[model samples]
Target: MRHATTSDGVRIAYQIEGQGPPLVLLSGQANDHHWWDGVRNDFHSAHSTLTLDYRGTGESDKPDQPYSTAGFAQDVIAVLDELGIDRADIYGTSMGGRVAQHLAARYPDRVGALVLGCTSPGGTHGIERDNEVRKSLAQPQPAARQALLELMYTPAWLATHQGPYNTLGDPDMPAYAKRRHLAASNQHDAWDILPDIAAPTLVLHGTDDRFNPAANAPLLAQRIPFASMHLIPGARHAYFEEFRAIASPLALDFLATARQR
Candidate 1:
């Protein structure tokens, strides 16, 4: 485990595995560094994979306040500075993808390549929740938690992982954990800035991503000057899990090509 202090004095936690060129994994809402457990080993074999717990999640310090994609981007930059890395290939999922887009646009020199998964371009495509889903998100914690679980995972996944989902009620999590999670969920929106990204990008989305429609993938790819799009078949919002076999190869190929460029 490693730690870096952001410009705002927030302590960010991260872990480095394997070796070679640097590759950073940025997770989505309600997730932390451990979210990459399934694919970390594969990524480690080809590059130095750095997985970090964003400020308000995982083992990192959590401060009570609003969270923004801009703040998260700074946290990532701070980590890179602490490690003396000039540039890195970045992979972000959902909300993390928004951060990556902002970083590539705001600090072009720091990004070697970019990959966005299951994310949207903001505006009409980003975070525009259905009325029912929006209402559920506005509810209090107990009810909100149930709504989140249903929305985040498919019925098939829930059927198999019921025990793990049920354990969320263990009551040991810090109050701020839930607070920050919800805060992030409600506050995140970066659709207005997608065009500023210039780094070579690869956008991956599942064909059946009910959370964020698959159309957003093309919308993003079309906006980024040098972006490519890949649609994973038979996958949902959790495309990484369903298309790991294909997605990993595609990611490695894109990173390799981007590095050479």
Candidate 2:
């Protein structure tokens, strides 16, 4: 594990692995760096990977204010700057995808390539979910996890992996962790800036994703000039878990191609 100090003096924790060109991994909402555990080894073998906790999650320092997508983007840029990396390929999922879009728009020169997974442009068709789930997220802990799990995974997956599902039922996470994550995620609206992304991009989503509809992928791909969309069938919002065998290789291939170009 390594550390970098952002301009605001918050210490961000990150892990660097593998060999070859550099690639940064940005995780989804409410998930720390460990969320990439399923595919990190595969990605590491192909590229030098950097995974970090976004301010409040994992082992990183969590401050009280300024937990917005734009702030998270600055934190990412700070990591790259501290590492002395002029440019890098960035892979972001859900909220991290929103950060990637912001980075590409605000600091285009620092991004070599981009990958967005299970995310939206944050417009009319962007955030679709049950009212109960939203209300639960705004409530408290443990219960928030229950509400989240309902929206994150499909019913079939929950039924099949009951033991593991139960394990994730009440994660040992802090309330402020959830608060900061939600604050950073809820206000994102990037639909207006899609056409400005100049880097080669890949947008991947699951056909069965209910949280952020799969149709949003095509909308993002259509807007970004140099972008392509891929849909994984029978996979839910957590498609990497539902179809790890397929999603892992596809992600690796997308990163590989993006790096080459």
lDDT of each: 0.79, 0.80
Top TM-score hit: 2
Q: Which ten-residue region of model 1 has the weakest summed lDDT? A: 164-173
**Where in model 2 is the C-alpha error above 4 Å?**
124-127, 132-147, 159-173
Clashes of each: 2, 0
Q: What's the lDDT for candidate 2? A: 0.80
Residue 95 accuracy (lDDT) in model 2: 82
Clashing pairs in 1: 121-191, 122-191
List the lowest-lDDT window of 10 residues for candidate 2.
163-172
Per-residue accuracy of model 1 over 133-225 as CA lDDT, tens digit each:
778767998898777666656677777765443212223436776676656645655566667777899999988676667878988898888
Candidate 2 lDDT, 202-232, residue by residue in tens:
8999997777778789888998999998999
